[model samples]
Target: MTDLLARHRAVLPSWMPLYYAEPIEIVSGSGRRVTDAAGRIYLDFFGGVLTTMVGYDVPEVREAVERQLRSGVAHTSTLYLIRQQVELAEKIARVSGIPDARVFFTNSGTEANEAALLVATNYRRSNQVLAVRNSYHGRSYAAMGVTGNRGWSASTLNPLNVSYLHSGDRLRGLFRHLSDADHIEAAAEDLREVLATQTAGEVACLIAEPIQGVGGFVHAPDGLFAALHKVLDERGILFISDEVQTGWGRTGDHFWGYQAHGVTPDLLTFAKGIGNGFALAGVVGRAEVLDSVEAVSFSTFGGNPISTAAGNAVLDYVLEHDLQANARRVGAILRDGLRAAAGRYPIVAEVRGRGLMLAVEFVRPGTVEPDPAVTTRVFEECRARGLLVGKGGLYGNAVRMGPPLTLTEDEAREGLEILVASIATVSAGEAVACGVSA
Candidate 1:
């Protein structure tokens, strides 16, 4: 393990800081758990950042990939379609309900989002895009332009055609800023106001995460998405939902996060759980929007045999095992456990999320100020106790927990107990005191 780290440091590029991790070197992983090089097993609450939905190194997926590997991995462009790719695309479209949705595959979330942006731009023939503040799309040139994370320099990277507004405010402002005062109507007026500012037949796309996973797991307000769709209808603009984190049944009740809002996006992109841990992603769009950009779309390695196999296997495992329903049940248990823990500790600020995508926010006692130190302590203590969770949010003060949907109820309870003990210790500014010691 030491040799592996040394070799990586000696040969790898310097951009490694882009990914966040602790000092431990993970050696292998399996159902709801990962083993480090030191032979210590850690319960994984973050689930490969919510990617390994069915759990790590799933045998069925591995077998499918091995079978595909015997033939070939990469295919010759979309020039020759494989049966698996076609079958997978059809399955995704049928599940997504985008009306004859066409699939444009990619290798990562950013590329999926990039493809969605291109479809939106070409279909509308407009350059301007609207996105919410703190929203994270991806870290590509165009995708980053629409991302609202202040740390990533998206604002300075591409200054034009990208407007930042609060999540709810983005939709509301877009309605009100585009039209005159008399035409404006309550909160819905903001959308009209912004759309009016763009040139006639302009404003290409409006992209947002169904649940802002990276941006604090912030759920869009009820009725807000449907209202946004109505405004988009009025202006003939495209609506894109970036489902990289919230897709593939991690959100509990629905397979796709947007389904929770009872709204369908003109363009939707997916990654993460589609391939479980393998490199796979895709952009699916309404037939009308997709057909408009059909000629312009092409990728060398997208939808290759191996990736398609992994994706199909993941879908099969998720459905066969009823992981979505498990996510709902386990998520409720986890949330209830966290709330109970919070009641026993005053430093806990709030707990928010749905299904398996949950977060426990920490704040300084007696004030609402974010407590990053407390969060760090909680994370470190959990890691020391053989449980691995993640931290995120604009303030870096929320303990993010999105374990694999395959997590057993017993395992989930054990992890929660460790977390509760850690939080209690951290919030009190001391370690647990054994009764025998005193």
Candidate 2:
């Protein structure tokens, strides 16, 4: 079977990008480690793009899924009663501190965003949605329309209702379009002016990622959202927080990324770590906002018994173990280690992000030009040394590391050592094992 899978991949062109696949096939995973078909084990710092919050194949999650399977009820229509779904929704809402919120489940993050767009536009009868440039929402047509990454999505330039607000100044170029004190006032004023010029009651929502995930993990400018939120609130515009990537304790200090900014979104979306690997996504919003479209909104596999069971188990484990506290502890260690490594290496331009959701920017040794080639080399070297990471940022030169919240200090240090060595070797132009292209 392994040989057959290898042969199948061999027939495909090497240049064919399989959405970050790196010429390797995995056979199994357990507890932050994956075993490739060749029996090579690797530490998975990427956490399946920060979705595997509880680590790979956690026994608690497995046991919950198995228990649900034995009950002869897994997937079910939303038309019927599902106790687990309600319980899961309550748990998520309680943790999020948004009491007057309703939860709508979906199969993935993109689907969650799709439902949000529908709810925001249709319920309010508005035509415009303002998002951040370089923000990533999802890949479906409507969700893709809101996402601002040009390389990830094709720019059809159709008459979509969504418009984007660009960040004002670059924060040292490692990050972009950031705002300072004066810039924050200017950006807020600019947005207010734009809203005033638009047709009355036309803008439905102003969507944003509390911490821009695929947009290079850029946090919003200081006081940017607080100032902007005032304008949106005055205009009765809904604030939507896309927490698909930053929710469920990936930010360490806060359960939800928006908490770091001290804002409560009218509508919030979540996926990834909420299920800890099981397929699930959700949209939580104010009761009034949700009630506006309750009669019209629908999803088939939104909140299945099995998925909700898994979600319940994930939440139980998180709270029981205080995983959010763990995330805070381990994240500090990771940030310090990576930042120190960055300070030591000239090739590493910046190490930025809060908590475990961190990234190291690769640049020209003495300049700000993005060094994608060097990044590609470093990724390959890291893979050879039994560590797995991810890449993002506008230029694809940021090495993103979002390990499971369950990772211990020792494990975090081990992963950092592997990354440090990989960067050092790649900087010296040494050959990396199991070479793969970006």
Candidate 3:
């Protein structure tokens, strides 16, 4: 499978997204490319859903893991102090903007989110969390309870008290066509009204993804969150920033996605890119929220020596080499190339996102209705040409790509050429199918 499946035991557990009729089994990778079982090498733009962050076969990460493995012991429980875990936690705290931050390691983003929810609910004495429309947090019942994207949500039987808001998605929502300032004001008013009418004034927290990942990379205008937070702040409702896809400078302009806005979240959850393919995730929150729990807490596998070692190496590589700046420079080039290509096709609805985290949505030629058929063709065409991208968004009409932050200028152009050509091919095919001249 190419694409990761979601929210069920019967479905193939979400691995890599598979758009091809015959799914390719990726056996190995180097740099920004992967090799399938058939020995077909292809440029990997999706980065295993943006998890293989620093590229394949990075020596620093490999060597760090090897050193930790050779240390003669690996499974010491969190009962004992682990030097690597402590060191990595210290580094993360420094990078995390949370004041007096306390870190709790988890094996994945879902667990990190669960931990954040636990702390927030405990501290605020409530389970009522405000979630934005089209937001995705995780797959656990607790996590899924707060999730707003119906595409990934499986059941409505939830334990947490969550209310949906219309502030996250701008492209398809009521305020999409409005100007930035007007959109901000309108959405903020909606939030204020929802708070006044929906639940008691003392809500637990508002959990959000700065850029909705599974919901098609949708985000509101700048300052929209700042305005929404003002209402939350007035009621003492905490804010949880889910940076699972938008953290670690993947968005180019900022290290954390929330940084793009002017305010800081009371708590934050992160995963996907921190370990560069290694299983590492955690929650960073203010001391009061974290220390509020009276019970002794520990995760047997979270922050295990091996994962933390890889995390240290990955963080070092990102900072020492300045890959964030690289993402900005190369992302601009990719966006420009995509914008120019979009001008040539009528089926392309929009090309949106920041830095390497970009998406292209497809729609019927003459209407706003999503065209998943054309989107599938474009995805398949890119694969036929040995370019591996991603397929996502609510209606499955958006193609997603986030090449490794280390992608070179030439590689960016190469992927862009293949992507644009695939769209051209698909668009022409659709044109001919409709009895129109291409």
Clashing residue pair totals per candidate (backbone < 3 A) = 21, 1, 8
Tens digits of lDDT, candidate 3, 1-438? 423323332565564344577777788999999998889999999998889989999999999999989987777877889898899889888888989998999999999999999999889988888898777889899899988878778888887888888855555687778898998888888888888888874789999888888888888877777888998888889999999999888889988889888888889998988888888999999999888877877799999888899999999999998888889999988898999889789899888889889999999987778999899999999999999999888889999988899999999999999999999999999999998965
- Single out the weakest 10-residue window by summed lDDT for candidate 3: 1-10
lDDT of 3 at 216: 81
lDDT for each candidate structure: 0.79, 0.81, 0.87
TM-score of each candidate?
0.89, 0.91, 0.95
RMSD of 1: 5.0
Off by over 4 Å in 1: 1-15, 18-22, 72-74, 168-187, 196-201, 430-438
Candidate 3 all-Cα RMSD? 2.9
Ten residues in a row with the worst lDDT in model 1? Answer: 429-438
Ranking by TM-score: 3, 2, 1
TM-score of 2: 0.91
Candidate 2 lDDT over 1-438, as tens digits, reads: 557647877897664464333467777999889998789999998888898889988999999999999999877788898998999999887877676878889989999988888788866787688887888888788788888788767666533477677642264432354337666777787788777775465688888887778877877664577788998888788888899998887888888888876778888999998888888998999888776775655778888898899999998998999888888898888888877777766778887787789888888776778888888878888898999898888888888888888998889889988988988887666223324221
lDDT of 3: 0.87
